[model samples]
Target: MLKIAMFTLAAAVTASVLAPTAHAAHSRIQFLAPSGNIGCQLGATPDGSGFAWCKADEHGWVTPQSDACPRANVPGAIGEPGGENLQLAEGQAPCFGFVMSQLFFDGQYAPPTLGYGEKRSVGSITCSVERAGVTCSDSKSGKYFQVSREAYKLG
Candidate 1:
Protein backbone atom coordinates (compact mmCIF):
# COMPACT_ATOMS: atom_id res chain seq x y z
CA MET A 1 0.00 0.00 0.00
CA LEU A 2 2.83 2.38 0.87
CA LYS A 3 4.62 1.75 -2.46
CA ILE A 4 1.39 2.20 -4.37
CA ALA A 5 0.66 5.53 -2.68
CA MET A 6 4.19 6.79 -3.43
CA PHE A 7 3.88 5.79 -7.10
CA THR A 8 0.53 7.55 -7.38
CA LEU A 9 1.89 10.74 -5.81
CA ALA A 10 4.88 10.76 -8.16
CA ALA A 11 2.69 10.25 -11.17
CA ALA A 12 0.42 13.14 -10.16
CA VAL A 13 3.41 15.43 -9.68
CA THR A 14 4.84 14.47 -13.07
CA ALA A 15 1.50 15.08 -14.77
CA SER A 16 1.21 18.55 -13.31
CA VAL A 17 4.67 19.48 -14.55
CA LEU A 18 4.04 18.13 -18.04
CA ALA A 19 0.59 19.65 -18.37
CA PRO A 20 1.86 23.23 -18.43
CA THR A 21 4.31 22.34 -21.19
CA ALA A 22 1.50 21.51 -23.56
CA HIS A 23 0.32 25.12 -23.72
CA ALA A 24 2.79 27.57 -25.23
CA ALA A 25 2.75 31.35 -24.68
CA HIS A 26 3.22 34.08 -27.27
CA SER A 27 4.02 37.82 -27.33
CA ARG A 28 3.44 40.53 -29.96
CA ILE A 29 4.68 44.13 -30.13
CA GLN A 30 3.72 46.81 -32.63
CA PHE A 31 5.43 50.07 -33.62
CA LEU A 32 4.56 52.85 -36.04
CA ALA A 33 6.68 53.35 -39.15
CA PRO A 34 7.33 56.67 -40.83
CA SER A 35 5.15 57.81 -43.72
CA GLY A 36 8.11 57.40 -46.05
CA ASN A 37 9.82 54.42 -47.68
CA ILE A 38 10.20 50.81 -46.53
CA GLY A 39 12.97 48.19 -46.91
CA CYS A 40 15.38 50.41 -44.99
CA GLN A 41 17.24 48.50 -42.31
CA LEU A 42 16.80 50.01 -38.84
CA GLY A 43 18.30 48.71 -35.62
CA ALA A 44 19.26 49.79 -32.10
CA THR A 45 22.47 49.19 -30.16
CA PRO A 46 22.98 49.41 -26.43
CA ASP A 47 24.87 52.66 -27.06
CA GLY A 48 22.61 54.25 -29.67
CA SER A 49 20.43 53.70 -32.76
CA GLY A 50 21.62 52.85 -36.26
CA PHE A 51 20.06 52.77 -39.72
CA ALA A 52 21.27 51.52 -43.11
CA TRP A 53 20.27 53.22 -46.32
CA CYS A 54 21.27 52.53 -49.90
CA LYS A 55 22.43 55.48 -52.02
CA ALA A 56 22.12 54.09 -55.50
CA ASP A 57 22.21 57.53 -57.10
CA GLU A 58 25.11 59.01 -55.15
CA HIS A 59 27.45 56.05 -54.84
CA GLY A 60 26.72 54.99 -58.44
CA TRP A 61 26.54 51.61 -56.75
CA VAL A 62 24.41 50.24 -53.88
CA THR A 63 26.38 49.50 -50.74
CA PRO A 64 25.37 50.24 -47.13
CA GLN A 65 28.21 48.26 -45.55
CA SER A 66 30.91 50.26 -47.34
CA ASP A 67 33.35 52.25 -45.22
CA ALA A 68 31.59 55.52 -46.09
CA CYS A 69 28.30 54.59 -44.42
CA PRO A 70 27.95 54.75 -40.64
CA ARG A 71 25.59 51.82 -40.22
CA ALA A 72 27.06 48.73 -41.78
CA ASN A 73 25.42 45.32 -41.45
CA VAL A 74 22.36 47.19 -40.28
CA PRO A 75 19.67 46.42 -42.83
CA GLY A 76 21.30 44.86 -45.92
CA ALA A 77 24.08 45.16 -48.42
CA ILE A 78 24.36 45.66 -52.18
CA GLY A 79 22.59 43.04 -54.30
CA GLU A 80 20.85 42.01 -51.05
CA PRO A 81 17.91 44.49 -51.37
CA GLY A 82 17.73 44.70 -47.59
CA GLY A 83 14.86 43.55 -45.41
CA GLU A 84 13.70 44.28 -41.85
CA ASN A 85 16.17 41.83 -40.32
CA LEU A 86 19.27 43.24 -41.98
CA GLN A 87 21.50 41.41 -39.56
CA LEU A 88 21.66 44.28 -37.06
CA ALA A 89 23.32 44.01 -33.68
CA GLU A 90 21.13 43.86 -30.59
CA GLY A 91 23.85 44.64 -28.07
CA GLN A 92 24.81 47.89 -29.78
CA ALA A 93 21.34 49.35 -29.69
CA PRO A 94 20.32 48.73 -26.11
CA CYS A 95 17.31 50.95 -26.74
CA PHE A 96 15.88 48.27 -29.02
CA GLY A 97 16.72 44.63 -28.65
CA PHE A 98 17.07 43.34 -32.24
CA VAL A 99 15.80 43.67 -35.79
CA MET A 100 12.60 41.78 -36.49
CA SER A 101 11.00 42.89 -39.75
CA GLN A 102 9.42 45.93 -41.29
CA LEU A 103 5.71 45.95 -40.48
CA PHE A 104 4.76 49.06 -42.45
CA PHE A 105 5.95 51.06 -45.43
CA ASP A 106 4.28 53.60 -47.71
CA GLY A 107 4.49 52.22 -51.23
CA GLN A 108 3.90 55.63 -52.83
CA TYR A 109 7.05 57.26 -51.48
CA ALA A 110 10.10 56.99 -53.70
CA PRO A 111 13.45 55.83 -52.34
CA PRO A 112 14.56 58.33 -49.67
CA THR A 113 15.35 61.76 -51.02
CA LEU A 114 18.99 62.75 -51.03
CA GLY A 115 20.13 65.02 -48.13
CA TYR A 116 16.53 65.32 -46.90
CA GLY A 117 17.04 62.32 -44.61
CA GLU A 118 14.42 59.64 -44.97
CA LYS A 119 13.05 58.71 -41.57
CA ARG A 120 11.68 55.25 -40.75
CA SER A 121 10.03 53.46 -37.87
CA VAL A 122 12.32 50.88 -36.29
CA GLY A 123 11.81 48.21 -33.63
CA SER A 124 12.94 44.84 -32.32
CA ILE A 125 11.50 41.31 -32.62
CA THR A 126 11.44 39.20 -29.51
CA CYS A 127 9.36 36.71 -27.54
CA SER A 128 9.06 35.31 -24.02
CA VAL A 129 10.19 31.99 -22.50
CA GLU A 130 8.54 29.50 -20.16
CA ARG A 131 5.35 31.59 -20.08
CA ALA A 132 7.26 34.49 -18.55
CA GLY A 133 6.92 38.16 -19.44
CA VAL A 134 9.14 39.47 -22.25
CA THR A 135 10.46 42.99 -22.80
CA CYS A 136 10.41 44.54 -26.27
CA SER A 137 11.18 48.01 -27.62
CA ASP A 138 9.41 49.93 -30.35
CA SER A 139 9.99 53.32 -31.96
CA LYS A 140 7.63 56.21 -32.54
CA SER A 141 7.45 58.30 -35.72
CA GLY A 142 8.85 61.78 -35.20
CA LYS A 143 11.98 63.92 -35.42
CA TYR A 144 13.17 62.63 -32.10
CA PHE A 145 13.71 58.88 -31.57
CA GLN A 146 12.59 57.36 -28.31
CA VAL A 147 11.79 53.89 -27.08
CA SER A 148 8.02 53.62 -26.99
CA ARG A 149 7.67 50.92 -24.34
CA GLU A 150 8.85 47.69 -22.81
CA ALA A 151 6.02 45.47 -23.99
CA TYR A 152 5.21 42.83 -21.44
CA LYS A 153 3.23 39.84 -22.70
CA LEU A 154 2.99 36.08 -22.35
CA GLY A 155 5.75 33.97 -23.86
Candidate 2:
Protein backbone atom coordinates (compact mmCIF):
# COMPACT_ATOMS: atom_id res chain seq x y z
CA MET A 1 0.00 0.00 0.00
CA LEU A 2 2.88 2.37 0.69
CA LYS A 3 4.23 1.84 -2.78
CA ILE A 4 0.86 2.49 -4.33
CA ALA A 5 0.42 5.68 -2.36
CA MET A 6 3.78 6.75 -3.58
CA PHE A 7 2.55 6.12 -7.10
CA THR A 8 -0.32 8.55 -6.49
CA LEU A 9 2.08 11.09 -5.05
CA ALA A 10 4.51 10.73 -7.90
CA ALA A 11 2.81 13.71 -9.53
CA ALA A 12 1.68 15.38 -6.35
CA VAL A 13 1.26 19.12 -6.21
CA THR A 14 1.27 21.60 -3.37
CA ALA A 15 -1.93 23.41 -4.25
CA SER A 16 -5.16 23.19 -6.16
CA VAL A 17 -8.19 25.42 -6.71
CA LEU A 18 -10.63 22.73 -7.80
CA ALA A 19 -13.74 22.28 -5.71
CA PRO A 20 -13.71 19.65 -2.97
CA THR A 21 -16.61 17.82 -4.52
CA ALA A 22 -14.61 17.43 -7.68
CA HIS A 23 -12.37 14.82 -6.15
CA ALA A 24 -14.88 12.71 -4.35
CA ALA A 25 -13.79 9.15 -3.70
CA HIS A 26 -14.38 6.43 -6.29
CA SER A 27 -14.28 9.03 -9.05
CA ARG A 28 -11.45 7.31 -10.86
CA ILE A 29 -11.58 7.01 -14.63
CA GLN A 30 -9.09 4.88 -16.50
CA PHE A 31 -8.53 3.26 -19.87
CA LEU A 32 -6.17 1.07 -21.79
CA ALA A 33 -4.71 1.89 -25.16
CA PRO A 34 -6.11 0.11 -28.19
CA SER A 35 -3.06 -2.10 -28.36
CA GLY A 36 -2.93 -2.55 -24.60
CA ASN A 37 0.70 -1.48 -24.79
CA ILE A 38 -0.21 1.47 -22.59
CA GLY A 39 -2.59 2.21 -19.73
CA CYS A 40 -3.74 5.49 -18.13
CA GLN A 41 -5.44 6.35 -14.85
CA LEU A 42 -6.81 9.55 -13.30
CA GLY A 43 -8.36 9.71 -9.86
CA ALA A 44 -8.32 11.08 -6.36
CA THR A 45 -5.21 10.25 -4.40
CA PRO A 46 -5.27 8.61 -1.00
CA ASP A 47 -4.91 12.03 0.60
CA GLY A 48 -8.30 13.03 -0.80
CA SER A 49 -6.58 15.11 -3.47
CA GLY A 50 -6.18 13.82 -7.03
CA PHE A 51 -3.60 12.88 -9.66
CA ALA A 52 -2.99 11.11 -12.99
CA TRP A 53 -0.40 8.69 -14.30
CA CYS A 54 0.26 6.05 -16.94
CA LYS A 55 2.50 3.10 -17.61
CA ALA A 56 3.88 1.35 -20.66
CA ASP A 57 4.43 -2.36 -21.29
CA GLU A 58 8.14 -1.60 -20.82
CA HIS A 59 8.79 2.04 -21.35
CA GLY A 60 11.43 2.62 -23.97
CA TRP A 61 13.12 5.74 -22.51
CA VAL A 62 12.26 7.71 -19.40
CA THR A 63 13.66 10.73 -17.62
CA PRO A 64 16.76 9.89 -15.66
CA GLN A 65 16.16 9.33 -11.96
CA SER A 66 15.35 12.63 -10.23
CA ASP A 67 18.04 14.20 -8.08
CA ALA A 68 15.56 14.96 -5.28
CA CYS A 69 14.80 11.31 -4.70
CA PRO A 70 16.72 9.14 -2.25
CA ARG A 71 19.00 6.93 -4.27
CA ALA A 72 18.33 3.27 -4.86
CA ASN A 73 21.02 0.68 -5.58
CA VAL A 74 23.60 3.32 -4.84
CA PRO A 75 26.28 2.64 -2.30
CA GLY A 76 24.95 5.41 -0.04
CA ALA A 77 21.49 6.18 -1.33
CA ILE A 78 19.10 7.13 1.48
CA GLY A 79 15.84 5.50 0.37
CA GLU A 80 14.69 2.65 -1.83
CA PRO A 81 14.55 4.50 -5.12
CA GLY A 82 14.74 4.31 -8.89
CA GLY A 83 13.01 6.12 -11.73
CA GLU A 84 10.31 3.62 -12.56
CA ASN A 85 7.14 5.66 -12.40
CA LEU A 86 5.40 8.43 -14.32
CA GLN A 87 3.22 10.88 -12.39
CA LEU A 88 1.15 14.06 -12.90
CA ALA A 89 -0.81 16.25 -10.54
CA GLU A 90 -3.30 19.08 -10.97
CA GLY A 91 -1.11 22.10 -10.30
CA GLN A 92 2.43 20.83 -10.61
CA ALA A 93 4.64 19.58 -13.37
CA PRO A 94 4.91 15.84 -13.95
CA CYS A 95 7.79 13.81 -12.59
CA PHE A 96 9.73 10.59 -13.19
CA GLY A 97 10.89 8.84 -10.07
CA PHE A 98 10.69 5.99 -7.59
CA VAL A 99 7.16 4.85 -6.98
CA MET A 100 7.25 1.09 -7.34
CA SER A 101 3.62 0.35 -8.19
CA GLN A 102 1.44 -0.22 -11.20
CA LEU A 103 -1.09 2.63 -11.27
CA PHE A 104 -2.87 1.68 -14.48
CA PHE A 105 -2.64 -2.03 -15.16
CA ASP A 106 -5.54 -3.98 -13.73
CA GLY A 107 -6.64 -7.42 -14.77
CA GLN A 108 -10.12 -7.20 -13.29
CA TYR A 109 -10.81 -3.62 -14.32
CA ALA A 110 -11.62 -4.45 -17.94
CA PRO A 111 -10.80 -0.80 -18.67
CA PRO A 112 -12.03 0.42 -21.99
CA THR A 113 -9.61 1.19 -24.79
CA LEU A 114 -9.02 4.82 -25.87
CA GLY A 115 -8.91 4.66 -29.63
CA TYR A 116 -6.38 6.54 -31.75
CA GLY A 117 -8.31 9.78 -31.56
CA GLU A 118 -10.40 9.45 -28.44
CA LYS A 119 -10.14 11.18 -25.09
CA ARG A 120 -10.93 10.47 -21.42
CA SER A 121 -11.34 12.73 -18.42
CA VAL A 122 -11.61 12.47 -14.66
CA GLY A 123 -11.76 15.63 -12.59
CA SER A 124 -9.32 18.14 -14.01
CA ILE A 125 -7.13 15.75 -15.95
CA THR A 126 -7.84 14.92 -19.56
CA CYS A 127 -6.06 12.43 -21.77
CA SER A 128 -5.90 12.09 -25.51
CA VAL A 129 -5.08 8.77 -27.12
CA GLU A 130 -3.28 8.73 -30.43
CA ARG A 131 -1.90 6.04 -32.65
CA ALA A 132 1.60 6.68 -31.32
CA GLY A 133 0.84 7.04 -27.61
CA VAL A 134 -1.14 8.70 -24.79
CA THR A 135 -0.98 12.21 -23.32
CA CYS A 136 -2.68 13.28 -20.07
CA SER A 137 -2.79 16.76 -18.62
CA ASP A 138 -4.46 19.03 -16.11
CA SER A 139 -7.16 21.20 -17.66
CA LYS A 140 -6.88 23.90 -15.02
CA SER A 141 -3.14 24.42 -14.86
CA GLY A 142 -2.31 23.21 -18.33
CA LYS A 143 0.35 20.83 -17.01
CA TYR A 144 0.63 17.45 -18.68
CA PHE A 145 2.67 14.41 -19.63
CA GLN A 146 3.04 11.93 -22.44
CA VAL A 147 3.98 8.26 -22.61
CA SER A 148 4.75 5.83 -25.44
CA ARG A 149 6.91 2.82 -26.24
CA GLU A 150 9.39 5.08 -27.97
CA ALA A 151 9.53 8.04 -25.60
CA TYR A 152 7.92 10.23 -22.90
CA LYS A 153 7.59 13.92 -22.14
CA LEU A 154 6.24 15.78 -19.10
CA GLY A 155 5.36 19.46 -19.43
TM-score per candidate, in order? 0.20, 0.64
Predicted candidate 1 versus true structure: per-residue lDDT over 1-155, tens digit per residue: 99999999999999999877653211122222232222233344334444322111112222223232123434333333232122323323322122334444446533332122223333433211111111222332221112112221111
What RMSD does model 1 have?
A: 14.8
Q: Report residue 124 deviation for candidate 2 (angstroms).
A: 1.6
> What's model 1's lDDT at 8?
100
Cα lDDT computed for each candidate against the true fold: 0.30, 0.67
Q: In model 1, where is the ten-residue run with the lowest total lDDT? A: 53-62
Question: What value does the lDDT take at residue 29 in candidate 1?
Answer: 20
Q: After superposition, how far is residue 85 of candidate 1 from its true place, in Å?
A: 7.9
Q: How many collisions per candidate?
A: 10, 0
